[model samples]
Target: MTAFTSHFAFEFRTGIRNKNLLLMNYLFPLGLYVMMSLIMPGINPLFQATIIPSMITFGILASTLLGLPDPLVQAREAGIFRSYKINGVPALNILLIPALSTILHILVVATIITITAPIFFDAPLPVNLPVFALIVVGTAVALSGLGILIGVISPNARLTVLYSQVIFLPSMIIGGVMLPYSMLPPVAAKVALLLPSTYAMNAFNSLAMGGTADFYAWGGLLTLFVGGLTAFILAWYLFRWDSQNTGSRRHPVLALLAFVPYATWLLIV
Candidate 1:
């Protein structure tokens, strides 16, 4: 427990030291929210309220899955993971650093959203604060685990950047960051449902729009829990401590597995 806490602190510090990443993790989402507020001044307050939560979730997703992994992959390639492994650090402890940092990042961002949300928009406070907090924390944990997994498996920094952008941008845009789910086309809506961000948005929207909790929020929480577990298992099986050591050609197979939960949700929900 001490080791986990110590490593978590170290990782959090490391994240703060990276100025560009720090800015993006902390400010980018807020910037997006502010921009949207300014550009669409005439939109309903309820719709604007939903945007804040969507942007918060997007911030969580970006920091964990996109911004954090690229450097981690590069560090692994440079023998950082090996050094830690030899230093009597457990693999799980090594993973904890980034995961914890990402969680902290989410908390700080969420706090900012909570404090400023009422000022910028007249959205009501969440109906069930405990459940809302749980969804935020759970989503962060699950996404952070997946980020560490990506760091372990990505071939290179370039690929990490490429892959993260490919996964994150469309997910954020279509998952109702800038546009409401109700406004999206049928096919686009179906595709948006296939991403975790959709669940996050729905959960947030439920809280903001009606001050009510619903199954959509629960579904989002479930998707994060189950999807994150699957990613962690695959990461354990597939992670190579040394980058020179090529992993199984099973990368595509594993990728498909990662997509399954969201895809299934799209089909059924």
Candidate 2:
């Protein structure tokens, strides 16, 4: 436990120093939230309430999808994992340390947005703070696993970034991050259902609005939990500590396994 804490701290410290990570993971999401809240047209108080949580989830999505993977891929390229293995550290611990650190940072970002959105936009605070916190933590776990999946499958830092963007942009547009579900066309709404970010928005928005969360919110949380589990399992199986793994068939196919839960939800919903 002590070793895990030490490693988690070290990863967080190192991540804070990376300018790219700082920009994409932390600053970009926060900036997007503030900017959209202030500048987006037709935003009323009620709309602003939902926007608060949705954008916080957006931060989690960006941080995990874009921010989390680069450092792991970079560490792989730098042979940091190899050094840890040679020092007799457990593989599972090494895999989880970076994720935990990333999740912690996302939580901090979420908290700041949650606290300030009300003041900035005259939005209502979450009716239930505890539920809001659960949604944030749950979303962080799911997104962090997806990030690790990207890190594990990507052979190099460049591809890791490329792959992250592939997931990020779509989620932002269709997953109800950039706009609400009611505003999207039917086809786009259906497409959004296939992405975990859509459910995250549904869940967070419900809790932020008030009253007991209905199926959309609770169901989203459950699906995200299952999706996170699947992504982590695949990441564990596919991860390579060596930087020399430059083969064409480096288990990139395994990334599809991360989508199974989302697909299943689409089928059921």
Candidate 3:
């Protein structure tokens, strides 16, 4: 317990202390949030209603995708995991402690956006406060799972960026953050069916805010839960203690199973 706490504490500090992590986890997200809050409402009169949720979603993307993955890959390359194993730290703990720390950072950032958006930008808050909090954590966990999974599967830091951006850029563009799901073209909307942010924004809009969901709002949250579970399970199965010393490994393509819940929902509905 003591060792776990110490490791957790150190990881939490890293979320703020490491320059890149700090930028992605705090400065980048908050800066973008503020920029959007200041400029967007003026551009789209309807933007205010969605600002809180969208920016909060963007913060999750920044914290998890931009902030989370490369460290794990780099650590593996540098033999950090090898040292941890020598000292008996479980891979589960190695993976989870950083994720938990990132989750904390996101919740704090989410809370900040939820509160300040209303006051500073006249952004609307969720009518369902408890559900809002629940879904924020839900989104955090779901996306963080993807982030860790990316780190686990990526062979190097460059590929980590590729994988993270594959989700990050699309989420920003079409995942119901910057653009409303309603306004997207029919084909683009279909493309969004595979993105977790689409579910997250739908949940926040329909279940928490007063907006209508493109799909079943509650069901979207459930999909996120299943998706997150699948991701963590896959991460555990594929975990390598060191980049060079990995034994027989599962094909990284198997990680796509994490999207089964999302794809299933897309097919069913």
Candidate 4:
């Protein structure tokens, strides 16, 4: 436990030190919001109220997809993971440190977006704060789990960055961050339905607009949690502690389990 705490502390400090990462995770979402707000000035309030959750979702995606995976991959390539393994650190503990830290960073981003939405844009506060908080926390956890899976399977930082984009970009676009699911074409909307963020954004937008939050929003939270759990389980099986044998030994097949949550979601919705 003490070792875990020490590792967690070190990871937290490391994350704080990365200026570029801090900028992307902290400022990028706000910049997007600012640009969108300026362009849609007349409908800024409604837009702000509607898209704040989407922005927050984007922040979560940035933190988990890009933030956690690249560093872990770099560590593997740099032999840090081997050092930890030789020192007798538990695998789960090793993974948990970054997962927890990323979630913390995500929450900070969520808070910033939530508070600023109302003050700066005259956006409506969530009608149900508890529900909103639950969804946010759940979304953070699921996304972080996805990050772990990405980190474990990626052989190096470059592939981590590439794969992270492949997953994050599609999820963000289809999840309703860039546009509403309703506005998307039928096939795209169906694809969006498979992504957890789609439901999360839908729920959040509904709550912000002062309507009864759709059951799908809560369902989205559930789907994320379940999917994230599956991803972590698969990651445990596939996790690589070093770059050695990375290309030949990867268990990309196991990664498919991560999609179970989406499949379950199809059943629900």
**RMSD of every prediction:** 2.5, 2.4, 1.1, 2.3
lDDT of 1 by residue, 1-269 (tens): 68777888777887778875686578676787677656664765545556556657878887887767777787788898789888887776666667777788888888788777778765445666776777787677667766777776778888787767766877778866667777788888888876667666666667444544324667777887787777766766666667776746656347547667777876565
Estimate, for each residue in 101-181, the C-alpha lDDT of model 3 and write its tens digit.
Answer: 999999899989988998998888899999999899889889999999999999998899999999999999999998888
- Candidate 1 has its poorest 10 consecutive residues by lDDT at 207-216
| Model 4 lDDT, residue 256, Cα | 67
Q: Which stretches of candidate 3 lie over 4 Å from their true place?
A: none
TM-score of 3: 0.97
**Per-residue lDDT of model 2, residues 78-151, tens digit only:** 99889988998787877788788888888888878878888877767887788778878888888888999898
Best by TM-score: 3
What's the TM-score of each model vs. the native? 0.88, 0.91, 0.97, 0.90
- Between candidates 1 and 3, the TM-score winner: 3
The alpha-carbon lDDT assigned to residue 231 of candidate 4 equals: 81
- Residue 88, model 4, lDDT: 97
Off by over 4 Å in 1: 43-46, 207-216, 247-252
Error of 3 at 146 (Å): 0.2
Worst window of 10 by summed lDDT in candidate 4: 207-216
Provide the overall lDDT of each model, using Cα atoms, as 2-decimal numbers.
0.71, 0.79, 0.90, 0.76
What is residue 250's positional error in candidate 2, in angstroms?
6.9
How many residue pairs collide in each prediction?
Answer: 0, 0, 0, 0
**By TM-score, how accurate is candidate 1?**
0.88
